[model samples]
Target: MEVKVASPSASRRSSQTKKLVGGKRGCHVVVKVFPCKICFRPFTNGTSAHLHARTHLNSAELEKTSLFHAKCPHCQKMFFVHHHLTDHLFVHLSREERAEVAQGWRHGCYFCTKRFRVSSHLNLHLLTHTKEKLGGICHVCRKTFTSKQNLTRHGFAHLSEDEKIALVKQGRSRKCLFCQKKFPDNRAYHVHLVSHTKEKPFRCDHCGALFGLKYNLNKHKLIHSEDPRPFKCDKCDQAFSQKHHMTSHKRTVHRKLKDFACPVCGKKFGRKSHMVGHLRSVHAKIRHPSPHCGKTFTQKGHLGIHLRKLHPSEPSAK
Candidate 1:
């Protein structure tokens, strides 16, 4: 899945650049910003990101030299790294549940259910827990938030309450007629308008990917670099190109602790297809019948899959 596109000479890139940047700086590509998946810390290169990732894993991870794979019970997502999986598991638990785990596993590792004999051994295990201390207080408004990003976003509201105003006036009255979203100025208003249309003007010179926004296209171009995956799950030797992808890989594949449940008959399954099959038998009736063959299917997706596989030239549905 690696796609390579030429430099500024490409058609998509030149067209996207003019529509996006709309200025003399259209030729320049977006700057690279590498953020750590675990802590959201930004770094310039993969070596630093890889080095920092080692901090998230316990020393025990190294002693055991074997392949490791973790799967989230709820969504059936898979993760390659142990510490990433452990760090992801907390998001699925409520505050009370998390506190319970922290207390109960205080003398043990909650993620792997591994108990330690010594107090210092348990203390070392705490480093693997990635969830930050929950209560973050805002300096200006004295407001509380769950994470640093929320606090930072909340702080923007108080940027200029009364005393001074920004030189470039924000037209709060300037609203998008189509979506009812407020915009600060004409430039922003026009940018918002692009989302309504099927047009994606922003372009990446390296890969020639199209994006509606310059910000997103610029962010996408970073993937073309030699070392796109700065963040590394050193525990499992897995590398992630994007920080969010790594976080999501951990959260969805590792932290989830329960199999997916069928709403109709209260059946649980590790795979989604199995649950769907359960629904087809108990709740849904076999309605979709094949024209050529005598076989019938309970769902359109199943029938479509059958058609694509067996009858390659036939239309999927009647």
Candidate 2:
């Protein structure tokens, strides 16, 4: 028989058929074969060829072309990854120019100097900073919130004006005996009482840790499990399991913005919760009245101390 060699396409098809029969399946099986420009290695898939071509590039060329072959939308600069392209886009502007642009375009949190992609997200994040009880009170349930936005959200659970009138006519009121607070329903009343009783109904399976809220229990379970931390900081070596932690780190450590200020003492805090805690401890004057004697203090802990020292005969609440 005369010696013969098959055409490139025919040889590729033959190889593909052999691979299919051997139970080897991939993108290279269907696509037109191409050789890498740098190494001249045969690759049926373009993406594989592109990736293989990168191995031949030096460090400088790799850095220059690295962004997964993505082109920047703003300056048309090429980068290896999407984030690299985004970072490079900022390099086109000066510090003053960037600051001026940020004034108009950036949606940033006042407490930690964290910037958000959207205004709604920024508004939602701002709620985390207001640790003090909000003045907005729900007329239907007498429930207070830290913000009018939260009050509006709580109002959705209550009956409408017509429904309220009908309930009044029926002489039905859902009220708690312990706190004398009204609720939308009996279920809401019972749920409210759980807070005062400090009930931990939700129990974790992996760890016997109990949480009052089901969501808090779920969040706690993440600590016990081996979860992947996909969100990584591009500016530093640090990586966080949660996006909020990453955002917080960027704000407090990188931006160094202390937006939360105590209303009574005028002390600045990086977080709203810290400011609220300081106010409660130093200024709130929340005194637990002694059942035996009329004694008051700033903190519940102090009341406990007084009870232990002066009124040792009386039993403590906890």
Candidate 3:
């Protein structure tokens, strides 16, 4: 063994094997390793690694350049080139459905129960439910979604804490006019205003029930479909289809945590909506006057009660 000497080829092969096994132990032995700074892909030479790293840098630059291009005025979808964007405008023009396909179209499908920006996009998305090839797949859940937008939204659930925080910060530049509340985006601010107006645009087709939020409409539809209640109460046998309902039940019934306190009456409410309703009934200005006695009340219920008790034969003033 003392007289034996390894050949140059054997020494080179050993070094190659060590470089191939680029773990902590092997990396310590390989002194001349040309590891890529971007992806850490090990290379035989520094020049090769540097060239490979430049490809990633070029891709990042291309993405930045693409973002600098003009976006569609209607859909706000970005275009890498002006000609491609001009061609996209024709799709919006010369159509009866053009009015509905405006900036905040929010096209929804009845079949897959998914929402989209444009009706034509929704039509194309519907084909995915019937065909396998067009289906959008989520890598994290391994589930198939009808549209890419739905899949993107599904991906948000898998985001890291830092990524989620950054995304929240990106959208939080806008503020609400009524409460001066800060929202992440304009869409969120509009949705929040629905609470103040008490406007219920999302309606259930099955039961003819109405909901202010699309999420609530989706949850309400589950009732007609007889979906299983996954979220259960720990103290009682009660279960709910939605997690927020379970949380609400727990806070109101079990925990009894009245977090939302009424500013006018000093009354505590388990939910913010309940507190808002209380404020509207007790503290809000009397807009609807009682035609029976020229008296005004904050709530419609109070006016109805006053009419029924005092002016029963007055034929119920409108």
Candidate 4:
């Protein structure tokens, strides 16, 4: 946890030192004598040396260290902050080198290279990656936790009613028989149970839409605002409130980039969903077949869409 603080005299002392030839190959013949105290890597000035010291802040042996912050794929050097790593690539790496390895950079996000100053902010950002598909629910129990710590201690959720009540009296657990989901407090337990009942107390005032989560309701309310669409397409006049939607628009429309292509057919699609839909409709046989006819569809929703279009007289499919 203990860190060595850089003294004010570092910069002054660096200025007094004479330039010398570096030991590393391809290094400048006459480089600034100032070097990192720990690694002895040559730098132009002491300020850079001090900044470079942050790279050493992260280590498996250190108690105050963070997750692998910023790793250089080239020399295997690490930087403690993303901005510092960015500066390293721009200043130390050649233009062609940066372009060659730019895609290798890793971040907390699986889909994008977005970086955050705080680890907690990064943790929050990661939830977005799962929320769209899984609705923030844990794949293990098919339930979501308000806090990350709760998910770790989820085995307690399976306790019997008597044991759960006893734990609640001991100020430890909040569980019920219905969903078998545990909470840290009585308030959270009550909220979790309400979701099971499909109450959806949080209602949007603008469109009269109900939502189970208050945060979801708040997000829905933004659509009715004067300037709800904050994220705008740089190339086009179209805009969207969410950053992901805007990014999808750019990829599908402006960029016309396709990451996935069908092996059976040479057809391509920008979005993974589109590619999947194409595969299920064109190539793969359907699992859901109509009882009335031999017609088949990849999804129940797709079948329902067909029914509405072809058989307008027929009632809506449940």
Candidate 5:
């Protein structure tokens, strides 16, 4: 259950370096990191490496004390660490619901009667009732959003009345004649065109949402759904159902500053995914599914089951 952090050069280290540093440590493996002295292949992070190195300086008394800790709710067995408790809980969940509940304990948490689309939703929702509190606000509208992302979306409404009218008149949707592909935005359509021309011009500022066209970047903007979207608060940790609602709440109540920008067109994007999608459609030549797959995905939920039955491991229709 102990998750290890992988080092940047773990694969390239040599055994000779391990022997030089580890010496007579009881651990069977002798591993070393190329550049980082505190990191090695055998241990995931600097903390583990330092802890292991401690064994060389002392014996049993100096070693981290092995002790009994948390108890399992069902089996009544004691675990040595919190992770072991977590692993045992997973096993319990996988089997307990099948036996304990007479009918079925719906997908919602036992404590809250609220239903969720997925267990992940329930888990995140549980955080609200728990001790976790992360929130945000919008500066222009003086509104409060549950998360930072909602505030960003609210800023979109602050765009000039002229710009909103212009975008609406332009028709946000379009199609690529070359690929015969349809997209929700014109920028996406153009990005698809660049793929045939082989261009990879723009790079994502945060990570790798790179693209060859500005519009493609715009289309990518709709992809990321923040935790506190419509009513939530955190920028990265909260979840939400709608972007506009979140933004409105932030600006009207909390006074959050807007800082989103488009990487391809140099225009500002209200949200990050909007920009990424624009870049992807215009410049990135993504291979669409075969016509057969497209035909099977006429409905949203049906597409999930179709892809699951056909390509169980690939992206599902959902």
Candidate 6:
């Protein structure tokens, strides 16, 4: 009876040992083994578990990045690291965007009817048309991102004026050295870089609008609005809402017909746009917005603001 009991006990002990060894068939020998809660995959140790969590984190990050980022202002892709975004914005700040603004027609999506300085800007414009929700809902505005990095950056936009002031006072000027541009946070800057490259990985099969930038493209869809321009001009028989519309009208219609000759030189132009081009070429000293003004603006909006504040009496129409 004693021999029989010992034999059964030894067999049971061997069975328990086999079970433990079988569980570790594919596991590394040096590290502790455990099951990952998120992925359900067996991990070598705690470090591996932590690293594995990043896979789960990616979904959140992608949403945040997509929502906050505009587009690759350069290549116009949705993917980028922190430093790459900086390198891209340098292109926009270059002469290209400025020249397009001068030409009156900016780069915009024909499908969405949205315009931007760069193709990347149009990429972000496309994200708004997405229907899917990403990441978690932002506490401040209920907005979402593909990731937390995007969400956190967006949160700063909701900061109060005093909070922003405090942040600036702390000597925390979050600027990217590559582009010499500044942002409230790294995430916002990272998100902004998405506007530089043209890589829309996510595409919609329905509308056929290819977007690399965002998980959500619902904002790109158009909706009818009550905001309509009713103002029309009698001199050239044109319509406008803002005063600039009238100026664009005059430039396109009446001014284009006028053969004005410069008194300083023998140059004739039908319109001011053509004359501005002529002046820029021959009399480089006589710049369009004034070379001696000690300031150069990227867009007409900035010049309009300057005129409104500095020279209130001057007409600042288009």
The best candidate by lDDT is: 3
Q: Against the hidden true structure, what lDDT does model 3 obtain?
A: 0.59
Scanning candidate 4 in windows of ten residues, the lowest lDDT window is: 1-10
Q: Please give the range of 10 consecutive residues that has the lowest summed lDDT in model 2.
A: 13-22
Counting clashing residue pairs in each candidate, in order, gives 5, 6, 1, 0, 62, 44
Q: Cα-based RMSD of the predictions, in order?
A: 21.7, 25.0, 26.2, 26.4, 20.6, 24.3
lDDT tens per residue, model 2, 97-146: 66776666578888985676568778777867765655587774354676
User: 1-318, model 5: which lDDT tens digit per residue?
Assistant: 122233333234322233332335533453443322212225445565546534322232245576434545543433445765664464434223534542343566667656654575676677566634344666643456555544554555656556555544455433343454444343344346556534444444435666656455544544643432344655444544555556544643365433444445665444455455545555453334433455433233455556667767653433
lDDT of 4 by residue, 96-168 (tens): 5555565454434556666544566566677676653323455433446545565545546445567766765
2 or 5: which has the higher TM-score?
2
Q: Model 3, poorest ten-residue lDDT window?
A: 1-10
**Cα-based lDDT at residue 207, candidate 2:** 63
Candidate No. with top TM-score: 4
Which residue ranges in model 2 land beyond 4 Å of their true spot?
Answer: 1-192, 196-211, 228-243, 265-267, 280-318
Total residue pair clashes for candidate 1: 5
lDDT of 3 by residue, 90-110 (tens): 454533344445435577776
Error of 2 at 17 (Å): 80
- Relative to the unseen true structure, what is the C-alpha lDDT of residue 239 in candidate 4, on a scale of 0 to 100? 88
Query: Which ranges in model 3 have alpha carbons more than 4 Å from their true place?
Result: 1-172, 175-184, 190-217, 227-232, 237-241, 263-267, 277-288, 293-296, 301-318
Order of candidate numbers by lDDT, starting with the best? 3, 2, 4, 1, 6, 5
User: What are the clashing pairs of model 2?
Assistant: 66-80, 67-79, 67-80, 67-81, 68-80, 134-146
Task: List runs of model 4 lying over 4 Å from the truth.
Answer: 1-210, 227-230, 260-268, 282-284, 287-293, 298-301, 316-318
Reference-based lDDT, each prediction: 0.53, 0.58, 0.59, 0.58, 0.46, 0.48
- Model 5 residue-pair collision total: 62
- Write candidate 6's Cα lDDT for 250-287 as tens digits: 75576564444443475766554566556655666532
